[model samples]
Target: MKISNAHLRSFRNHNETAFEFGTRVNVLLGENGQGKTNALEALSFLCLTKSFYASADATVMQQHGTFFEIKSVLLSDKGKEFHVRVTYDDEKKTKKFTINGADVEKFSSVIGMFPVVILSPENSSITFGSPADRRKFVDLVISQSSKSYVENAMEYRRIVRQRNMILSEAKGKDCSSEIAPWNEMLITYGSRIIGKRNQFLSEFAPYIAQTYLDIVDERETPKIEYAPSISIKPDSSLEEIAAAMEQKLAKKKNDELRFQTTLVGPHRDEIIFSLNGMSLKHFASQGQHKTFLVALKVAEFFFLKERCNETPIFLLDDVFSELDEYRSRKLLSLAESLGQIFITTTSEKIFGGAEWNNERRKFFIKSGEVAQEPVTA
Candidate 1:
């Protein structure tokens, strides 16, 4: 799917702005704080039904405005079109995500329809940052491709929250029986999450390894391993996994009461990134960290495409500056395999004039405004 047009109102610094796009490649050029990244974030909203970076709807709303809206049309390769819109109200803290003017019941229904892959500087944290960063990366990829996974993951988080509340509320001994229902719920939901996470890692491993090697052009083998808080027996069935989770949670009851938190589950898992059998965070240089991050995104693109059976809209959000000429060209060339790409850059000269198609529309964004940037050789 390709975004044909995007209109943003009161989002970030953008009070009102709209721009049409080319089918293959669309570039946004501007200096810092000129709304270049905001445009891409708007496009991400159209696809993902929320801002890619902002944690809450209010964070993305313009400081001077109380509400923000993003509307766009997505065109399929078969010439079909989908009208998508996302709106947020600050006072109510409400968001409306819709397609064809019909409210979307859940984000899962909206995700696979307009699959997206985003690569930005912040993604570097996936390599050098905490385990939560890597887990989020995993969830975003798997959720887009599988609706069942989405439901299970959401339910898992809710159960975790409820369990934590019970832990905090208790003030006496032997509250294990009080939290019993929550433990069963956790087993029910957490097992599914862990199972799906392991399956995704199994599918995504080779792709990441191959892509990382190609990006770094080095001999070191990159590996991604799922280290779950609950051990998943390879020989065990789903029922057996649930039983194991229940048993483990029962065993950790004393520790759970002592700490006032649920300790054993996928919520505490980690995605270990290693090269040559050593942790990437400790052994890799800054440049190597950046390369590994891009490789993960590139692998995510292919992973979603393979699972969803459609090309996902790829967003490169001003990350070209992190790479040298060769790596930048490598990224662009890899992007060419997909049907549509959106790039935000501060320097128009990064990719060079010859690299962009004359028909590939380029836009200059400034002060929340977007207009066509003329293509000249």
Candidate 2:
């Protein structure tokens, strides 16, 4: 799968611009603040129907532009074509995402349709940040790889919010009976979430270990363990896990009223990463943290590919500067085995030893405009 072409209109600083690409290494070469990262942001919105950096959709539109629109023509290796369009109205703050002119009722339905993985400076949180960051990465990967997971996760979140509201309303009142319905929904969805997360870690751990060794030259990976609110066997059936979660939440009802929040579910779960039985987030050096994050991302790509049977379009957004020459080369080496790649670099010197195939295309982006000529090395 590949994006054959894309047109960006009124997005960020790009008033109007379009580019065509093939299935190979394509470099968006330019200096800082040249809209190179902005282009990648557009592509991200096209794939995910949301912005990773922006808090809202319309914020990505240009100040003077009335709307932000991006349209891309996706081509599959099977000789089929998909038209993906994402348009946001600045005035009304509405977003429309469609494939082949058909309206997309839910964004998750189309997330994995054009799967993409991004390596950027912003991903540092996945390694050195809080548990929420790590859980987000895990949820995103699982959501794309499994549509049922997405539905379950979404329903779980909805149930959490409803449960929280009920707890708040019952803080000093006698509404215990009303909250039971929410708990029933929560247990149904939360158990599935916990079970899926536990199962995912078991399946994905080997890839993380191998990728960590291949990239960081480490003998052991940071030990990954899924810490759920309710304990269950790795092979526990969904019904069995739900029963356990239901009983646990029943015990926590008094505590929930005391805290005025829902406390017993996957939302409260944590993924602990340790090395040599030491907490990696607290004990690992900065370099070690970065290597673990990179390894996780690489493992993410392989996991999605193996599960989905399609190589996702890989995006490396100004991450070379974050890595030394050796790791940059290592990342490039692994990426070459895949399909389309969009790498943005502020310095051309980084490509001195880089290899590009016959299908390679390099161009310069300046002030939201794409130049046909490649920037000089």
| Best candidate, lDDT | 1
Report lDDT (Cα) of residue 171, candidate 1.
Answer: 47
For model 1, the run of ten residues with the poorest summed lDDT:
350-359
Every model's Cα RMSD, please?
2.0, 2.2
Q: What is the C-alpha lDDT of each candidate?
A: 0.84, 0.83
Choose the strongest candidate by TM-score.
1
Residues 1-377, candidate 1, lDDT per residue (tens digit)?
78888889999989999877877788888889899888888888887777779888898999968999999999876678889889998889899998888998877777777889999888888898899998998999998999898888888899999989889888435686778888888988888888888878887998998887777765878898888887775445678778878888878888888898899889899889988898998888887788788888888888888888778899998878877877788888888676688899988766575444444778888888875554533
The clash numbers for all candidates, in the given order, read: 0, 0
lDDT of 2 at 30: 85
Q: What is the per-residue lDDT of model 2 for residues 86-180, given as tens digits with 9 covering 90 to 100?
A: 98887787889989999999888887877888888889888787778878888988877888998898888888898788879876566668987
